[model samples]
Target chain A: MSRQAFSWGRLPAPEQRLIKLASRFDALPTTTESLLPYGLGRSYGDSCLNSGGVLVGTRGLDRYIAFDRDSGVIEVEAGVSLGEIIELTLPQGWFPAALPGTRFVTVGGAIANDVHGKNHHRAGSFGHHLLGFELLRSDGQALHCSPTANAELFAATIGGLGLTGLIRRASLQLQRVPGPWISGSSERFGSLAEFFALSAEAETASAYTVAWIDSSATGANTGRGIFIRGNHAEGPNSTATPKGIRLPITPPQSLINPLTLAAFNALYYWRPAAVARDALWHWQPFFHPLDAVQEWNRIYGPRGFYQYQCVVPMQDAETVIGEMLQRIAESRLGSFLVVLKTFGSMAARGMMSFPRPGATLAIDFPNRGAPTLALLDALDALTMAADGAVYPAKDARMSPTAFRQYFPQWQAFARHVDPRFSSSFWRRVTETEVT
Target chain B: MRRILIMGATSAIAEATAREFAALGDALFLVGRNPDRLTAIADDLRLRGAAQAETWVMDARELNAYPALLDEATQRLGGLDTALIAHGTLTDQIAAQASSEMMLAEFQTNALSHMVLCTELGNRFEAQGHGCIAVISSVAGDRGRQSNYVYGSAKAAVTAFTSGLRQRLHPKGVHVLTIKPGFVDTPMTAAFKKGPLWATPATVAKAIVKAVQRGKPVLYTPWFWWPIMQIIKNVPEAIFRKLKL
Candidate 1:
């Protein structure tokens, strides 16, 4: 990951790897240069980025070194995508312990973000499953590190946003599922109060839970959503084998407007109840519904969209979540989908992981204009008031002050790994303090 | 995340490609001859959600200037994961035939520029031992036609260069992708008639993204053009000359 700097949006900063790699040279070049270290390119902001330098894109280095079928242990390159892993491992009755909303992310990215999934309450974040990794230091040395070996670097590298070093490969454990199917049920909630109650109650038993809110809904109906809870199908008798179906390509002009999404959400809110665990389902429908349609992200249009996700502690969950919904509705910057879930445990290993003892909410809104920024600012305030913080993976608008306020322990991690401070995300958020 | 760099950043197709990559929040280095356009496009890319976007303005035709320029771009973008050479010129074949100066200029811009860019990119990819290179060529390069062979010849050179480059680079962790666009509707091709097969800039961008993700070695823009050009390439010389294709 040797590069000089990275950029996210209009922001720019020098990468740590660039500084380290350059120092190794017998004579340092006068001109400033850098390289951007990239993980599956799934981030919503420039956190895992560097620009105006050499970019060490790790996507193609994907290779599955070994997979212990019996123990569900897997060793793979940092660039190995979750989709590739799932395609190869799921059929063998093994699955990642935790995953982000999408399956396109690389293992390096998943580790960087310390991503949590629907089963976060049950299995925790990716850091929990991560056992070790091959780290390519700024000086070009490949050293293997684990909990017992270079433990601080391992902890810092997890959720470190590729600032510590280049993650060459990772070894982790996979979970064995009873079947590819999930026995899921949906219940409608009319308000934030109902939503929180239902979510908390469901967390006690369900292995997976998520809520879909209509960001456009206002007043009494604001935050109204369909709460979904699911557990792995008990056995083969619980469901049938799934079939393969793919939408080859996305139409060049599929507009996902308020009207279109409204109709879709209405059906989504009602349709889940229609199939009340009558039969077995395919994993694609359950896990990667968006994958069915290739390039589905294009539906956001040329301007694209930003996904804002924040986790609010239980103490301030109601007011924070309610105020966020109210502000979003008032802003009129509508979102196609708003998901809510509760995270039960924390992966202490990751330096900057997002999850905590709180209810996490993710809302995707098309970039309309200034109102979008304004709304996000307001949401940030509300989340902060609730003792919450935003997800770094899906964030593009968070301020350094906000980041500092949210992650007070950042200084410790920053000093430990990249004391000189080399990372686009670090440069942008803490411009004055980083380098 | 994918780290993508576009050497010809200001082109319509490159702008669209930048937007697509930006949507994925990829870090990008947009290089071009015009600083204003590069900065403007980079700003626009950021607004569209690029995690990072930077601009570099330099004459791509100056092969000697590439190593430094590339060094700057790579430093700016972090490291080069993939570099897409979207730079090329569209010259009038009749004008080229009328003047040797016109032919030389066209060849420099269309073929030589890409050659230099590809060589530098290929070396970096090889150094890393893993990366992808996507270059935008023309379907006309598959076989020369009487109407635009001058431009076709340059593209043909680029096409042949890319094929050999791919063979050498692919073995060393670099995946070379050649995009042969038949008739893309852009400022360069606006004078031509628009037809079903003539793709929009956005379509070309979409196809390029798909090809990179799929790791396809070579692809015709619309996919159908692959078969169309196959038949065209195999056509008898006598019959091909009589046809106005």
Candidate 2:
């Protein structure tokens, strides 16, 4: 009925801040019992949320602190989103070392999750590129920490779910790109085995490698996928090519479905199976194809979907991924774009941070009621049994047990941060305890 | 808990409305088609501290799917307190004139979709006996201009639907509001120039939230757009036909 609208998830008590210093003062809780800090509110799950306690909004405090063009390093307010950073840096030929699917995510979010990207196998995670950050401790003290200083806090803060302290600002190393163009190639694979082989081969030559799996397939063809590999192009090849088509608007998700997707895919696959080996392409096409369609996520019918992204060690990928897909298909929960990427080394050792030397699979499943949740639970178990972890950015459902099993560091992370630091993701994971 | 459902979860206005409610500690249900973006927005809302935030990735234009989705959303969020019907389409005038299919499609998306949404919302809100509905109609709907009458006609219909629903639901304690944004720089109007006066997402969001809180029956986002559109609407047909919007 007419109830007071609360956020769709449980979060810690929140405090809206207009100044940057508020976020930098680590433990500046209104009271001794409350403590939590968040960036631009980008973390998909509660990793950045805290309930009944202090939640520092970083949105108001965004500002470019400093930049070293020679070294390609930038220091900005923690609230600054990657999008903001890119807008300011892209023209200068600097890019984030690692990015999640979207540019709207904040630097603090990237650091808190130690986010990875399509080029994760080659560049590692956002943590690798981070030089230092300002940490506001639970006691309300701002401490500048890096690998060399306050090493524990630094390590703890990275992928620490914002527990160790509020990140006020961060100095991140920027990637130097030759140009804004990428030379790309797309190859279709008939099976998971081929996909894996192609991915491994592409890793050796391409700057970025990603695969789209057909999760609906079963049996011998359970994991047929499409392989996309790309490398940054050196110079402009085309005298007249659109810089890139950014989605002016995202078509309603109804425009895409199994039938439409099938047609779209069929047409998509028909483009010579491979395109410009060394042709110039805008950075948007190379990195964010989905960005082309603004609000493209609406395609999932009214039954919203969950993005299930998990990284299984390469050794266990085939068995674990095969079983995961098998379960999804058995449940009849179809996924439109099933992406597969190889993770490189982890840059940070934060608990719950998802990245490792393995293969990560991401899929979307419309919420088909209890069956979907049950299926996801089963899949989580499978992922954990294989020592795989889930991506916090793309996660809506993952129990505390699953979180604990996957991220053994959760306890330390939770304990180190303010006890009040919580989120919907955290709430869902820890629902039994609070509810 | 304040239970809010954003129908067009991915719309720029919808996203901003979501952020507003989310920042206010409401439980949010993001209903839209792009499950991925909805999921992303849900995560964002969650991270921003929604008491709880979830997504329903469904095509709003598919009326048949509304009841089932609403049932699930109500259960998930506990219940609905407020619903923001923000889904819309700015049909290309040239394309609509060129093809009958395009014209009908625009009407279906802009007009029929709202009809279904309003029907479902009216039923639920009436049954609940208390709720609020804010529909995003365009100022263009004030009077169909030759530039985009197909789209304007559809919005005009929505504006009427919302008005009638408001009249019927007032006795039931449900508040219905019509939001007419004039050239808000949304994804829908990205191609159009700012043309002297255009509102931003934040401006529209702020206005909508204020109106909802203040219980305003209907509001023009920029306020000035009201008189501006009124003048255009009141202009004689002969005179209107001779001028460009």
Candidate 3:
């Protein structure tokens, strides 16, 4: 069967021939069309998408292959989502060493993107906890990849954007935690400099740390936001995590206009915060706030939105971020959702991993066509000038020159990409640039 | 503990339904044709909070083995209060028409096996004084259409058997749920193009779990199928014969 595949950002994807794979042994179709192993469409951009080719949907391979509660080690089909793993292991007092903001992403998606979470200051990206995976190639070889085995492919496939081949199954080292509860706290920072100082303090105090920036604030309050941090709580938790309610219907048009965006950002930052100062949070709320409202992405409506996330060097983060925020505040085209966090000195295991020693900033801009695209371009220019890289998983329209500049190792990573596998993002950057 | 026995435990809907039961902290004794698949499912169920999971390797069509399977499951789990039969083939109508052997084989798998299991379980549950049996029948059984009457006829038989069994066991405090699911997206129907009418295994499983809990005797999964089936079933034969349906 064939269907049009759209991404999480509601960007229209190209028509794709659909192939359903149930088992690890399922053969890739011998057709000449390119094939990409597509898990949940959780990625915000074209990285998880294929155009005029086949998308091997991995939904059927979702299974826990092996688990050791005692050792906190799990072997799972790459198709298994993080949410499923948590459901299975959390009761046994184990959790993924690293987790993205949303739990909907499959383990394969996490590996393919090398997703970073709030714990980037401590646990690093998802690649660090990955033990190994079985890579099924078009040539019919199932190679076991890890730091020791098929090491190059291991590095390439992690953050490889599903271009290398299909990751059938993977083993991960999970961290042991007390329960499904987080000991958390938050305090507002007055300025961009204060945020940098406070995030450093929060990182030292807690395992998980991230901040919400008020991009609408200007001048003295340029990067003012909330610095929130948490660690797994000790002892029992009486409060139960409420089941997240889904956005049942998509609105006719984008609800996040400039008026609403500015209002939301102001209220989010300054409203006499109701959440307790030293609250014990359910891990669900502490980690996956947006996931709770399933399909909240559709609220951006048919035109969709673009998520711009980039990591600049920690050396000049404040100046770079301040300039970017000032530009956004001046333009009045900012959004409600803005996040800032820092990455530790630990390098990502992926050869093309996006996370580095940097202070990262992410914002969502509702697609206003050329205007939004131009804004995204300006943000990219600032990031590149500061020698930072835009996260491909979060980008829809990054320029080829910018991509090459951002990921200088793209040439090396290109050598390892499977001959028969490619993605829209890969083609957009390389094909257009080369041609 | 919720002790449940799942026959054809590796089928998509069965596995999805087993997941629901596991989340309820059920102790499961899973029966399936493949050892590797069953072991994988058992372990997954254990991780999903099934208090304990045991597996037996045998196809559900092996009717003779079912009694021993039941006894083994009852002995292993201490008791069994719930059983879901969610195994069948959507036999290729063209292939079945060409071979009586293929047609009978499909009947044996889709009908006779389910009927025998129901009879065995009905006796056991009636003797125990309480239990719930959920057998997945198809909406195609309501009125046999030309395209899939072979498979539909078998489901019709199973549905009739389940209905009679439900009446027989109701006085004895047993719940027999005959599931009439419309098109479901499973490996069984992977080749067919899906439309708005299709329901996911999880959706069907959830409705089955709800009906089983409420002791409902009949269920048209997704609820909307109930009216659609009613319209189809009420189509008079005189006019139905003129149409290609």
Best candidate according to TM-score:
3
Q: What stretches of model 2 exceed 4 Å from their correct place?
A: A1-41, A48-55, A237-267, A270-276, A346-351, A430-435, B1-245
Report how far off residue A203 is in candidate 2 (Å): 1.7
Lowest summed lDDT window (length 10), candidate 1 chain B: B39-48
**CA RMSD, predictions in order:** 14.9, 20.3, 2.5
Best by DockQ: 3
Clashes of 2: 60
Model 3 reaches an interface RMSD of 1.8
Q: Write the per-residue lDDT of candidate 3 for residues A180-218, one digit (tens) a residue.
A: 888888888889889888777778879998899988898
Query: Alpha-carbon error at A45 in model 3, in Å?
Result: 0.9
Of 2 and 3, the candidate ranking higher by lDDT: 3
- Candidate 2 is graded, for docking, as incorrect
Worst 10 residues of 3 chain A by lDDT: A1-10
Tell me each candidate's TM-score.
0.61, 0.60, 0.93
Cα lDDT tens digits for candidate 2, A317-339: 98888888888766666666778
lDDT of 2: 0.73
Q: Please report, as a residue range, the 10-residue window in candidate 2 chain B with the lowest summed lDDT.
A: B187-196
What TM-score does candidate 2 get on C-alpha atoms? 0.60
Using DockQ as the yardstick, the better of models 1 and 2 is 1
Can you rank all candidates by TM-score, best first? 3, 1, 2
